[model samples]
Target: MVKLDNVDRGILHELQLDARNRTAQEIADKVDVSASTVRNRIAELEGDGVIEGYHPKIDYEKADLPLQIMFVCTAPPTERSEMVDQILDIRGVVDVRETLTGRRNLYVEAVGTSTTDTVRISDSMHAMGLSIESSEILRQRQVQPFNHFFFTDPYADGDDNGED
Candidate 1:
């Protein structure tokens, strides 16, 4: 684990808000540091493996795969590795998470053109001998960058309606 000072955390907060658009100078402006300092810190962070990589924030609905299905399963310990690899290789599989605490050890998400494809993916997992406890998804609600809200609230530029 990294032990970051207040300034380091502040720089990270700014970067988290918008890594693509924010330049080092802009981030330095927000965090009260020189641009060179921000640049150096970021380089160090990347070297230390703290800042791994950047990714485009994708909207699944806008993409062709509007239907999302998550399968929560419990597979034998022996089969976990192979099951994960197979899941990753499967078409339409977007993400797979292994959990420490739950009736299900793995949560696998797959995007489908329709509900039938989602079921087919789950059934294939069953064929691999995984015990699927549940398969469900609703396209109604989602929150983006929700996990980092607390870390970067100081730099957020969004309008708040708390007064109203």
Candidate 2:
């Protein structure tokens, strides 16, 4: 495990907030460090695989592919990990998750333009020998950065004396 100092945590928090638009200098300002330090720390984090990759928060509905479905299935405990790559290969499959539990151990999320697309995904999974327990249409998903790395607003302070 990589040891992260307060500055590293601060940098990670700021980056999680808006990695694409927030520059190193902006993170440095919030972390009370120099831009160079922020950049170097980010490099170290990436090399250590702590920061895997940046992903956009896409709105599939706005993109005109509104059908988002989650498939909960049960696979042989020993085969779940091996199935990840194959399941991902299925068109429209966006995410696959393996759980420690025995029943309903495999979860797959997929996007589609129509009901036929969803049916095709189900047929593919069935062909792969997966028992689909349930398929639900996902309404929404929300995400937030880990709160352990949370920081107070840079402009907010202990001295809260009637200020907007």
Off by over 4 Å in 2: 150-164
* lDDT by residue for model 2 (61-130), tens: 9999899999999988888889889999999999999999998999999999999999999999999889
**Top TM-score: which candidate number?**
2
Model 1 sits at a Cα RMSD from the real structure of 4.2
Lowest summed-lDDT stretch of 10 residues in model 1? 155-164
Q: What is the per-residue lDDT of model 1 for residues 58-156, given as tens digits with 9 covering 90 to 100?
A: 777888778888888998776676678888877888788877654588999888888788878877888888889988885654534423424445445
Candidate 2 clashing pairs, residues 3+ apart or interchain: none
- What is the C-alpha local distance difference test score of each model? 0.76, 0.87
Tell me which residue pairs clash in candidate 1: none
Candidate 1 lDDT at 98 equals 79
Candidate 2 C-alpha RMSD relative to the actual structure: 3.6
Local lDDT at 96 for model 1:
89
